[model samples]
Target: MNFKPIPNKFEYLNWQEIECVAKNKRSTVIWPFGAVEQHGPHLPLATDSIFVDEIISEVFKLFSADIPLKKLPTQYIGFSPEHKGFAGTISLSSNLITSMIKEVGSQLSEMGFKRLILINGHGGQISLLNTAARELRSVAPGMAVFPCFLWSGVNGLSELLTKTEIEDGLHASLAETSLMLALKPELVGDDRPNEGNKVEIPKGWSLEGNAPTAWLTDDFSKSGVIGDSRGANESLGKNLKELLINHWSELIMNLMQSDWPNNS
Candidate 1:
């Protein structure tokens, strides 16, 4: 049987073609997760979803067609309780998210797939996805599960952004705005808000760090922007896009060439 590399998307293949790839000992599937949540007035509600989807698609394009890698459809709604009060925000329960991961993972294991990579785009669901990945691994022990954040472990961020932007720019901020400009400038709104950076916690505490608080978007940001976007531009967005594509492509290529947990 002539088997395609399973590039672009997994869902596009027929069941027989999918089964062929699944039966390959080194085959891997990536499932991207994103959120339909608030990203301030300057960005679309599907910012997270769009970023993850587009970035992964670009990563897929970098691989040789001979590689046995395929991406599942992007899960567009994620656990986003912090953005509950904002318009256009859709947050799923933690239980529901975990259950979805397990059910899909179990099926993949049954089909003889070797790996499931959850590439998540939203920061709010990071812990939840980690928990879900472990639970999926527990049930589908034969399948390796990797829950990864889209923005984590990427290089050159500090070189492009300030310490303040790195730490405080949590949401629809400079990085996000600039990235959106590079990807889909039509979806970007005209407003570039500079709010929510002043909600001070005690020294040594942060919105998300050691001694983090259970904070909601409404608790600090009125404009639904958590950092300054005044300095964002398409040039920075292009740089960020390049960084993401190059990073993920290298990581995934390494994964495809090795057995990892199953390697002796």
Candidate 2:
């Protein structure tokens, strides 16, 4: 079938155009990963998916036409065992996720693509994706995969949110709710319950850090919220959207402009 090139969309191009673009050693493909999981009572099950899809689309829009970057469709379902306690949460097996990444990366490598950037929105799958990336590199030496979390390396979060929110707001919290309010306010529920903040642990131990615990959503939160969402508003969400878009745009632009992995 004949097809028209739709800017930076990988799937929009016809097979011939795809092959031509893939032949470029500087060509980069972005695959956004997110989860079909619970986000407390106030948010939709596809919260993670929606956020990453919107953020990546905005980031791509900011890039110039000369950038050799194209995006694949978003991987909506992800590894989310931590949220399995809540209804409507679908958790994929770790092996399945790793194998899927390997298979996809292998095909991209075979197509002569040089770089694969997996921008993941779900925090639960970070290490799994990292493992998949490393394994993909081993199996397919022609292409490099960079697994990135949505919130990582983004600046200006401290200016808009409190330290407690940054640390303990793991799910369905102020930042997420606010960002959702900015991106998809109609999907956000009005009941912003402030729960899951009173649990106490040892001094050195933390929920997530160098020392971490594999806790379930039902453990500390009956409502499934892991932080306070009292002051969540649309304004905060707007600021968050800008920060995310700017951070990812700069990062991907830098990647497109360099030949870092192949430089050595």
Candidate 3:
């Protein structure tokens, strides 16, 4: 059961069709930003992409079936290269990813889709997305570019997870592993690694590494895992998914109703 919905129309859709659908249906054009990063030994390299697509599909289905929210088509843009050191990790430079997103947002704005939401599945692309949003706003002032980091977007759900030492929740952790098991159980392996070694964090050190300095994903985890993935379960994934959908839906609706800054 492949989860992609846009299918063949990904690269060939014309502005007319996109505009028509968005305007008539009040649909919000969604662009899922994912990375081809390693997910430990159990999960696949495409875990982030797969999980993101599944979550969006589930939310779209819920909207189409029950909620009156307009259904929007989503496209996947894989731009992962930071995990290249690890097996099966493919990444793109920050410049390329940022440029691609800006181009997409600009085109969508031209198509009359003022509301563009970036559904980010990978943490590596967070700053890039922010940069792209700012640039897009500069070009298309009327357009509303909202980049939703799905993990951070889910409010209060992180506190529910048992693991507290997991910083940034990189690679495969309780959150991601649980999401995979829930969304695509067939892909997860049963082997569990013993937990004893933890990522050494210097005294008063933060994700930014040195004082007010930024760090990459590789600087965070050695095995590419932040939190404890040994206790991941399907129940937690489902709960997290529900929470994210509700939260994002509310935010999107609010954005739709609000006024767009002339230089936004």
Off by over 4 Å in 2: 1-5
- Assess every candidate by TM-score: 0.96, 0.96, 0.79
CA-only RMSD, every prediction: 2.5, 1.7, 4.6
- Steric clash pairs (candidate 3): 80-90, 80-91, 81-90, 81-91
Cα lDDT computed for each candidate against the true fold: 0.91, 0.91, 0.65
lDDT tens readout by residue for model 3, 105-204: 7876676665677888877677778888999889877667777777775676856674453444555877778878878899998854423235465778
Candidate 2: 10-residue stretch with minimal lDDT: 255-264
Model 2, 1-264: lDDT tens digits are 965576788888778878888877688999999999989889999898999999999988877865778899999999999989888999999999999999998998888899999999998899999999999999998788899999998999999999999999999999999999999999999999898887898999988998999888889999989999989999999999999999999998888888867823
Model 3 alpha-carbon drift over 4 Å, by segment: 1-17, 22-27, 64-81, 163-168, 194-197, 208-222, 257-264
Residue by residue across 61-122, what tens digits does model 1's lDDT show?
87877577888999999999899999899999999999999999899889888999999999
lDDT of 2: 0.91
Instruction: Point out the higher-scoring one by lDDT: 2 or 3.
Output: 2
- For model 1, give the 10-residue run with minimal summed lDDT: 3-12
